[model samples]
Target: MKFAVFFLATFLVASQCHGGSFRSFPLEMPTGYGDGVSHDDVRCASWRLAVEAQNIFGFETIPEQCVDSTAAYIEGGQYQSDSKTVNQQVFFYASDLKIQDNDVVIFNVDGTVLSNIPYYSQHGYGSEKFNSTRYDEEFVNKGDAPALPETLKNYNKLLGLGVKIIFLTGRLTDKKAVTEANLRKAGFHTWEKLILKEPSNGQNTLEYKSTERGKLVQQGYRIIANVADQWSSLKGGNQGLRSFKLPNPLYFIE
Candidate 1:
């Protein structure tokens, strides 16, 4: 009886440490899939695992990649390769075993979630005639811009996970106070840092944001994820392990 009790206790501890059963799908690309697989392929693979997880464990989790796909087939399950063999294998493990919420995430300010679309529209700055100074002034003055629903949801999720949030914006440092207020009003309660562009810094948006991220790394922050709307906000050195680009059709920044 004592041995039985000890074995049960050990099993329970192992299960708790592993965070239940979660299968990891193989990341290996098929031979004909080319030297580099597309992002869709990776996402599809993830979705496949999510589907299996739902089926086996009754978890309702869905992969973010299939959120917009029209085909229910792809959304439902991963398609088998032409070779009649499953290209991916799922491995069960703990979710937080690798990178937990304690890791850091870098987010871009403007188009990412601040929802500057309406503001830009009200100011008459279309995609063609975007003036940075005018937009910045209006944005700072308004201080009540709405947040993007999808991105905002993801942001809140990250916060719930205990991830450190850092804002790296192209906005001028002078507007820091207003930006902070705006973020707070928009329900972003806490963050590690809110970095803005120095007025004297002549670097472009890409360069400036990249340098800021590098600074975070120098300060001993492990950036596990980067979320932004513009590619410029993501390109450059000190990039995180994973990047998620939100859609931005308003204006392009170099």
Candidate 2:
């Protein structure tokens, strides 16, 4: 019985280390898509890497054949494990920085600082076409977004190191209220600024982000790190000192 109790304690500690706050695994280690990986698993894994590397652009839907395999990858806890690895690198970068008074971390809201998994899980983990209206109503407008556990940890660590947090998202200007509420509900209590898209802007996300970040630079805020899941959100002029991309297999933008 004591051995059993000790085993449970070890698992809990390991879970905390793996950014496994959102999942509970019955196995000592994540099985990673059952016993053996199939052809579909290999295909989906490669596609997911391509998605992360921006090799594929403007992908509106995940491939139908890869949907089930993708689901297993996410639900089986490998998603969090992969995320933890990325954040571990990010944390290392942040740890070595010499923060200044105006130094800031740029955080893209959705799929970066926030997790929309609850909404996506019902939609086949992003295999379905993205319906902007439905997504806004059910996910955005409701102030129901949850924090990405890995990000929240690094965010606080950066804060403790004296760097200010600035949230820069592609969400529109009109969502200010619920966006603030959702951010707070998701455990982000403060930020230096919450920059959002202007409804009338004609530029794409990359252009929009570049323009906004330029303004911040002119105003004397030095971007320490620009963190986001979307490459568009991380690229362009005034890009910052360094950029870190988080793992997101759900969908691609720009």
Candidate 3:
């Protein structure tokens, strides 16, 4: 006779994008822990939690290592949305982990993600598909949107603190000039860098953002925070020190 044993586990990755970028060090699972338990199972569990973090709280990635007797801990609404407040903490059981905070932070340009756009109407708010014509129209009209008051205040405050800021967006790179104009028009005065997606890039948000962030790191920049509305903008490598998310239930990308 064979018996099955279920195991609960948590793992962490450094520098994941959660509405903002933050560093999350990985934890090693103990050896000879459970029967029939594979490393992939642990990773899958972690990935599921990461996905939930993004779906529910707009976290680009899980900020901390979490483990529980069952996966229900996360499913039970124990972790709230990150957008509700800046200082809220998510609870998780894990061995031992350490996080390092960086000084530079990255922001997504989409008003739904980071900056608030009071004048910009959320046209694709209820769209089912992300690559639809309506989405394209929305992006084109983003220039007409004005920045949100709270977001502008935070941007200015971070800037005043001498924290280097980078603007990363999935907008077509061809619209670089126009995007810059729109940002300035919307009161975004200064930034260390502005990254836009290229037409030929052929990479999803996760791949594109991760690759770009890696490039920045290679260039000697430390990414401490990442702010975005979409999960794609947050996942992947070179995540950073912390991540902050904005509410966007309109559409989701695989």
Candidate 4:
């Protein structure tokens, strides 16, 4: 610290003697930064990794500094690249599975197969608080969310390989029509099952999804793989033979 101060002082004194302007440098890093960029971006990148690994939990919104960084990651192709890498690994695993008439690949709707980028981008890229009502009315009900390109490719490949697809979504039963319509519109043309949550059932994602997938197992369906963006949707009893978690730096649900 002393050496840095002395060097800076000497630099300023030399500049003055030479009649040259000294460039400004802050002694301390600022908390906030320009145009949403910040040191927190570096920190938030690690934070996001933790979030993906399920080390971070119950985050209702993203860190304020990460809004821009997360947005850039989503819009600037990194998200797709990351998805491609995960999906490639998924294909390798799914391709090796022995063929069985009862085998099925279970998928989550929101962030796994389809993207809500339009909705999230509008909602501060997860910097803002989550509003279920607003999200449902303004975004989900429209039934036009686009398919994530990489997951869509994986879906097609799995389908062509004779692996049955099952959509197990947290979307409410009331949304069945719009969600189903949206699935078709988003290129998920066929699936063995499109299970939606009943609004009256008051279970959290882990419990609800576990119960649902467990029921499938009871009915003699061999779960080939389970795929979702949230760890809560992936972990739990009857979590399939394997699980693929896609990246989601947005909101975290319990």
- Maximum-lDDT candidate: 4
For model 4, residues 124-206, the per-residue Cα lDDT tens digits are 99887778899999899998999999999999999888899999999999999999899899999999999999989999888
Candidate 3: Cα lDDT at 242: 68
Ranking by TM-score: 4, 2, 1, 3
lDDT of 3 by residue, 1-254 (tens): 97554554443433333343333334356676555865554654555455446523323323223223122332243322333343121101000123223356687887532342222224222212234455445655556556644456667766655677789988888778877887888788788889998889998788989999999999888876677767778778998866666544333443
Candidate 2 lDDT over 108-181, as tens digits, reads 99888889888889998987878889999999999988898888888887788888999998888999999999
Tens-place lDDT digits, model 1, residues 142-182: 79887755556666766656677888888888889889999
What is the Å distance of residue 190 in model 3 from its true position?
0.9
**Pairwise lDDT winner, candidates 2 and 3:** 2
Candidate 2: which stretches are off by over 4 Å?
1-35
TM per prediction? 0.60, 0.84, 0.58, 0.85
The list of candidate 4 runs beyond 4 A from truth reads 1-38
lDDT of 4 at 160: 82
RMSD after Cα superposition, model 2: 10.8
| Candidate 2, run of 10 with poorest lDDT | 5-14
